[model samples]
Target: MQPLIDEARTFPARAAAHGVNLGPHTTSATPQAMFIACSDAHVVPALITGSRPGDLYELRTYGGRISPYTEHEPTSEAQTIEHAVDVLCVTDIIVCGHSRCGVIDALHPDSEAAPFHLAAGHWHTLMQFDALSAYPCVQARLSDRTLRLHAWFYDIDAGTTARYDPRASTFLPL
Candidate 1:
């Protein structure tokens, strides 16, 4: 914690040295995409995507699970998804799951998938997509073919990402 505090204290100088100017990052954000990942600290959307400050709007959930959208009783996840789709008008949505995640293990303890492997995380990633698609805003954008949804798996140990290919019905290296 002390190290983190020290890093934060020196971030301004480091950011300036790295040519990261914060002046243009206004309060309003128009991100290119909405990235949903696990709440695990190891899975950082910005770092994983090499994204600048506001390039990605992020929503994190345990095991990257998205609660099904209930029209009569909307959840915070639904509201955030609505804002990203309808207000921000983001063109893409990505749901990412990472290896070595305890969330996945707890969600499916009976599964035969090797513990903490990317394959073990596949089920939940797809489940999140299924829930995300149930959102009205996502449905509208998808119906108009103006928005794209992607499921990705990250190997924590290897520092590599894989994207699910609908055509192949398999996860492929990205």
Candidate 2:
């Protein structure tokens, strides 16, 4: 805890160096892409894409799951999509899932059941299904037509990536 607290103390220094290190991003930020990735600390969009600040609008989820866009009620997924498309006018939206995901394994029938925090349980419920389907809930959400949604598999071990081809229903080397 002390170590983390010590790291937190560097915030001001980092903030002060923002203009020096991130000077190019000093202007208004209007990202051209919306990156929906896993919340895992291992996966950082800026680091992975070699992008600096304000280049990408990111939404990180436990399983990098995408909720379908709907007009019924105000939802975080809906709001994020609307803002990214209408407000930011982002051209592309990427949904990336990482390898060896505990969340995905938890949803697997063969995997052992373990207690998760309330938020994790709720997020899992969004992907839980009553019937056996080839694709997960997130895949189903990407099937929507309004926005061009892409699913990617990021392998941390091999440092390789694969993109899901919905038409082929497979992950191809990227």
Candidate 3:
């Protein structure tokens, strides 16, 4: 905590030296991309994309899950998506899942592990596949061609990345 505090204390000066001016973005944020990623400490979207502060509107969830958007019961994930699309008018939405994901393992058919002790509401939102189809915002945007959606898989151990190909129905190395 002390080390982190020390770093925070000196960050302003270092940021200024690097020409990272926050004045323009202080009033409003206008990120072109909405990055939906897992809540894994190892996955850093800014680092992965080499993006500065206002480049991405990030929405992180446990296992990168995209919960269904119900009119009566909208999840925070849905709200984030709506804000990014409707308000920010983001052009691209990237759903990034990584290898050895805990959520994927939990949902695996072959796994005989005990039920996860997640909240009851969260447990109900968990599904095996078709995450993009389940998301209302994603479907609407894609159909209208107003936004492009990308599904990416990061191989944590292999240090490689793959993109889902709909025609091939498989992930191809990027």
The backbone clash count of each candidate, in order, is 0, 0, 0
Better of 2 and 3 by lDDT: 3
Supply the TM-score for candidate 2: 0.63
In the order shown, what is each candidate's alpha-carbon RMSD?
2.3, 7.7, 5.6
lDDT for model 1 comes to: 0.87
Per-residue lDDT tens digits of candidate 3, residues 1-174? 999999999998988998887565564668979888888888888877778889999999898887766878887878888899878888897787776667656665353442432222133222312565566666787789998877777767786767777798666787
Q: Predictions ranked by TM-score, top down? A: 1, 3, 2
Best by TM-score: 1
Better of 1 and 3 by lDDT: 1
**Model 1: per-residue Cα lDDT over 1-174, one tens digit each:** 999999999998998998777776665668989999989988999999999777999999888878898889988988888999998899999999888778767656765656535556887688788889888889999999999999999988899999999899888999
Candidate 2 wrong stretches, greater than 4 Å: 1-28, 109-148, 166-169
Error of 1 at 131 (Å): 0.8
As for TM-score, the candidate ahead, 1 or 3, is 1
- Backbone clashes, candidate 2: 0
Relative to the true structure, candidate 1 reaches a TM of 0.90
Between candidates 1 and 2, which one is better according to lDDT? Answer: 1
Residue-wise C-alpha lDDT for candidate 2, range 59-110, written one tens digit per residue = 8777666555444765585566567766776656776767656675666535
